[model samples]
Target: MRLLNNLTVRVLIAITLGILTGYLFPETAAKLKPIGDLFINLIKMVIAPIIFLTIVLGISNMGDLKKVGRVGGKALLYFEIVTTGALAIGLLLANLIRPGDGVQTAAVKGGDISKYTEQGAGMDWTEFFLHIVPSNAIKAFAEGDILQVLVFSILFGVGLTRMGELGKPLILTFERLSKVFFNILSVVMILAPLGAFGGMAFTIGKYGLSTLLPLAKLMGTVYATMFLFVFVILNLILRYYKISLWAVLKFIKEELLIVLGTSSSESALPQIMEKLETLGCSRSVVGLVVPAGYSFNLDGTTIYLVMATVFLAQVFGVDLTLGQELTIIGILMVTSKGAAGVTGSGFIVLASTLTAIKVIPVEGLALLLGVDRFMSEARSITNIIGNTVATIFIANNEGEFDRAKYNRVLNQEAKNELADYKY
Candidate 1:
């Protein structure tokens, strides 16, 4: 009880236990993997509806389609710039570190790029754009079509906005459901430590250190470069701004621990929003930025994509000239947006990029596949922090931030309790 009350402390305990479990009882921990898989599935089960309802509620409250477009456009532009820079930096570091330099290993089997769309991965751009319409809302929900659900939710919300008073009951009902789901999220979070333990244990057990020995430098470079970017670039951005990353991150240290342990930032989504509110962001801003960014502004992961691509091509001794590398970045900028938010998304996107570049074999993705889970926590942790900071900074610039509320939030237990109490 005491540990749970101290969020950061509890999360640290979770991490320590997970690492201990993974290191000390590799076989036993590996068998316990279902706990993590089940936890992830439970979260995914709620995602489509949560995104639909939250987005609808958020948009309906906006009350103006024109405003929604403006906010969305600005938000997306921010995502693009930040994400591009991240990819470039990753490319740069991978080039500098040359982690796989002077190493020779037998090539692994490549991927079948055709598999992406067969398994609930989003369709191609044309088909995706066309299928925005839900043939049957019930079936769409049952199938868990996020884009379709997003489209339906947006249109429904716009209709509600246009309806004004008549839609109040429906909107209120959605609000209630949103709270219920969020409560479900909190209860689900209790399993975070178990998930972290099982997930970490299985990852390390399956791929021992020997798998990563040759590529450790590459991994180290990626992590080190991100550390510099966060401390340096992020400092410059936030020093002149309200709402320090350090403070907000400290507040949500528990969420970060879960993210670190499980390597799933999505698991931390609900708590992030709650903490954002407690950090005094307008509910609208938090509602708008976080969900969309989950799909869009994955800067840290973007870096890994470009880095891994170039690093692998280099290791393979295939030369991608400057023009080709730039072209690859441009292609990734667009495709990465289409990437899913689930586990192994980075690998999937890497597979797609490798196929497009026609340089490195899709098998190159297999190089980092084992360690991908390890890198995932770093990527996700930085991505969330960067996204949150960017959103707050943008809101501050737009005069959308509430400073007085922010100060009150840090000091006031009641408001923090309200944020904690999802239902």
Candidate 2:
């Protein structure tokens, strides 16, 4: 009973009940989507402000513009390297497992994939880069375009830093505002269980368990590959830093669970930022890397893009040559970054990649529409972990991490676990 009072426990219970409700009374479960939407909106309401304040404060406080550029450069390089590894691993596994083989093509349940295809077809790399610079900063925040806001914030921070002593007061004020928004996030988080319930209920009710039958192989392969990437690839990286991957996972288990429930990494963005700071990563590193990672360092989305593309090719009996597979990789490397941290962005990016490849039928996406929501949990969880690890790596390498604080937090957490066990 006492354990039931914990937020994690309560959220788990809510998810279980939600799935049951969706399975039993799908009509009613579908209605609960608004409850989840409200929770996400509440979280989104604070996101723009929090990001603005955090970025402004983080950059202005750093005192060295060169360090900022260096950090950004290192982050982008790391993101490319890591996500490329993810793409390769996904491609390799999909080829080996052949999850799409022997599947009847008639199993496709065509949905309106035209929107995604249109969005993909219109995707221009130049336009995407230009879109990062908002015409009006206010409109960027209003629209919640993270990349645009990031560009604006970086420029704003550089301008403020140029002001030298004159900027200190404004920086302090922004710091206070950042705290206020985080407090607002705390209040909003109280409704997380309800959000989880609604999100799970709606997904199950809308799609139903029957959708998993035909594509179970693909779904299972995706999850297994992600598991391999996390434990094998990501763990190797973490081990080099002398950090335990399992320990880090346990530390952020709550955030991971929240992502699982919502199927959106954005739902836990602010909280993850706060936790990373608490874990001793510098505020500036977290501010820049975390937001940027949402756009560029999408390890999970890259994996999915490559895997899904190959799976679709196999489903349609299109045999991609070695050169074609390499083309897929190159295309996805660029297109995958187009997928933001939103829930359905992956589908759009996938559509875009497929159209770019021009071999696989775009209609193959219909096969994934039903199980996409289910696969999102793996994607979201992997994304959060990847970004968090990236921040830690960058911070530690740049001497932005506080080793003493990290040890203290880890030790305290260990003590808390021991106490909980004893009781």
**TM per prediction:** 0.87, 0.97
Residue range 1-423, candidate 1, lDDT tens digits: 433675555667756776677677777766766877877777767776777777788788778789777777888888888888887887777777787676564543233434542332333555544665788888777876655666677777788889889899998999899889888887887777777666677766655555666678778888898887787777677777745667666677777787776777776776787777677676666667777787788777877778778878877888778899898889789767766433356766777677777777666665676677678888988878877877787677666788888777666755565656643
lDDT of 2: 0.88
Model 1: residues with Cα > 4 Å off, grouped in runs: 107-125, 128-136, 143-147, 341-343, 412-423
lDDT of 2 by residue, 1-423 (tens): 566656777789889988999999999998888988888888889887887787888898787999999999999999999999999999999999999998886775657778887877777877777777899999999988888888888898889999999888988888888888999998898888999999999999988999899999999999999999999998888888898888888788878878888888889888889999999999999889999998999889889889999999998899999999999999888888878933368888888788888899888888888889899999989999999999999998889998888889989989877766676
Give the number of the best model, judged by lDDT. Answer: 2
Q: Which residue pairs show backbone clashes in model 1? A: 110-363
